[model samples]
Target: MTGTHPVGTRAPGPAGQWLRNLTTPPRGAGEPPVRLLCFPHAAGGASAFRPWRGLLPPECDLWAVQYPGHEDRVGEPPATDLTRTARQAAIAAQWLADRPYLVFGHSMGALLAYETCRRLDHLGVTVPDRLFVSGSPPPHRVAAAPADTDSVPHRMHGYEHRTGTETGAGPDNEQHDEQYDDLAAKTLSADLRMLAGYRPGPAWRVPWPVTVIRAAQDPDLDAAAAAAWQDYAVDDVTLATVSGDHFVCFTRPHDTVRLITGAVRR
Candidate 1:
């Protein structure tokens, strides 16, 4: 059944493809023992998970969900219907039917991960053995963001975390030109529209284990928001706390991968 969860962006394109960096060699031959699908946040692109290639666990092959209208797929129309995107993702993942796999999503991508899993099960394909949700509130909690045109910049800044392309000078970040800011505004404008129209259909659940991950310093998701996932989970959700802020996964890729691999294996 299509479901809802209390939980929880990017210029995400349509979902017919997966972005992968093959640097991490699989364990033995054809495919690894496990597969991990990484979904990105709003205004974010699959390139965000490129660095994770090296950090992949030996038994797992990492595949980042590639939304249309971004990077290499820039020619295609960007995906706006979240559910349809999830269904497409599920179909694209049919190849993983014979492999043990895990799914991970951050922020808005968390919702995508959950929905994609549901689609897989509905298709009688294969469901992930484990699903990890990070930095997102549950489905019922996601509501249309207020329409305050003046706050678009602030909201754009928020989505930048998902984009991992924060402007300005920093050790890990570099300065971008005014054009980048314009692009962000355009993207956020589209996101506001999506949020304004999006309505979570119903709560969804699965028999597989669901891990709710929260960053210790996340400003948007407090302990209560993180725990709300327990209500929608089919089984008692596993709550995990890790170091960093909302964009923790990108900031600490190694730690994030380590935590995921360790938790799933356990």
Candidate 2:
């Protein structure tokens, strides 16, 4: 297990008060160029994206969304509703958007990321320059698209938010396998319920360029479903197939990092 990489401090809100509520900060090397706001998948948390921190370039900061009731926020109660969860994420994105930023979402996160982008536009806030969708179909096809219950091994590490760091990795995770499985089982079940209930009402569209990142060996990805994403984009839709399974973002993260940096800096 790779150890820890030092993280930046949590800055106060634009008004000077610490963001105790939803006013969160980016977690990466230094000040942002264009931040990469990452949202996790079903039964996933901020820790799932921790591997990308070291793989990311210094110019862009990463804010891996710690969904309510997942990992460090586990005590707050899980969000099984799609729209409400996306609304909360949009609020966080709004607070953290001090400059140009890109959005990356994998699996369930792709849906949340798209919804957040939509909400941002509705709020008159600046939407992401580009939206990177990884291993997930567009909103319209979600009902028919399948769910991946075994992505990234249910990251067992605790979500360390002390100054916005993702630490706590060791062999102990194996020790708590049974316990972790229990928690993961519950969370995954709730997420499946949420996914089963999602309805992407009429008028949902992604006006920005969309890059669909597909995992080479992902059995859950339906080729036609991946191609269907093009229908929702007004700008352009590009498919990128890389290594690993449905959880390619976490399994082979360098592929994702390279794609994100190329997009954000280009």
Candidate 3:
């Protein structure tokens, strides 16, 4: 109930239905059941992947999993635990039970997709056809403190990457009466709180081929961290470099799309 929903779960209210539908195949039948589920970093929403639809092959369906707290879920409370986030993704993966699919996540979203696949394995469910991780280290290599969410302002710190670009750590003019500074702090704190509390297990691993996309300009996504992805995949593994900082996927839409589409085609 707290994280992303599986494909067929009874839709929630207007917002819930929107989230659910986002995970469904957009085109009636042109797109095949071979889907690509995308998870955004902290403070990111499903809409972050709107540009990806045009980049993939017709055999690939696109679904963007919306984590609570951004976009339509703006007024709703954000998730505080990685476990909860993973569970939500697992639930949504069920809709693709009969179809072959892959998962693509960026930064915090990368970790979320990895853990969700692990949870599916535990449940004897079908793992993703492939795993695409961008700008994140393997779960086994992470050794950070649990996110701190006790206060409104402290939570956003968990989402800060080495590059300092936070998708959700901005001013909230509508809610905080133009107290932009305080609003930014609160938004950042929430994202940080969610990140700090996430602790991945050593046993978690993906049985499918895994691809890692690194931002050439992102300080957090160095060669060493990108190489660490080799330990997580059970099948094949590859690492590709792209332009821009941590937010390059958003900025360099065409190149990112080409890379993603090319990967799926293979």
lDDT of 2 by residue, 107-151 (tens): 888888888888988888877878998878778777765554454
Report the Cα lDDT for residue 255, model 2: 80
Comparison by lDDT, 1 against 3, better one: 1
lDDT of 1 at 250: 80
Pairing residues by index, what is the TM-score of model 2? 0.80
Worst-scoring 10-residue span by lDDT in model 3: 1-10
Where model 2 places Cα greater than 4 Å from the true spot, the runs are 1-32, 145-174
Better of 1 and 2 by TM-score: 2
Tens-digit lDDT string for candidate 3 (33-113): 576777877666666665565667767777777666555555567778887878876876766646677778887888888
Backbone clashes for every candidate come to 24, 0, 15
Lowest lDDT sum, 10 consecutive residues, model 1, at 1-10
Shift in Å, residue 205, candidate 1: 1.7
Prediction RMSDs, each to the true structure = 7.1, 5.8, 6.1
TM-score of each: 0.79, 0.80, 0.75
lDDT of 2 at 186: 72
Runs of candidate 1 exceeding 4 Å displacement: 1-31, 144-175, 264-266
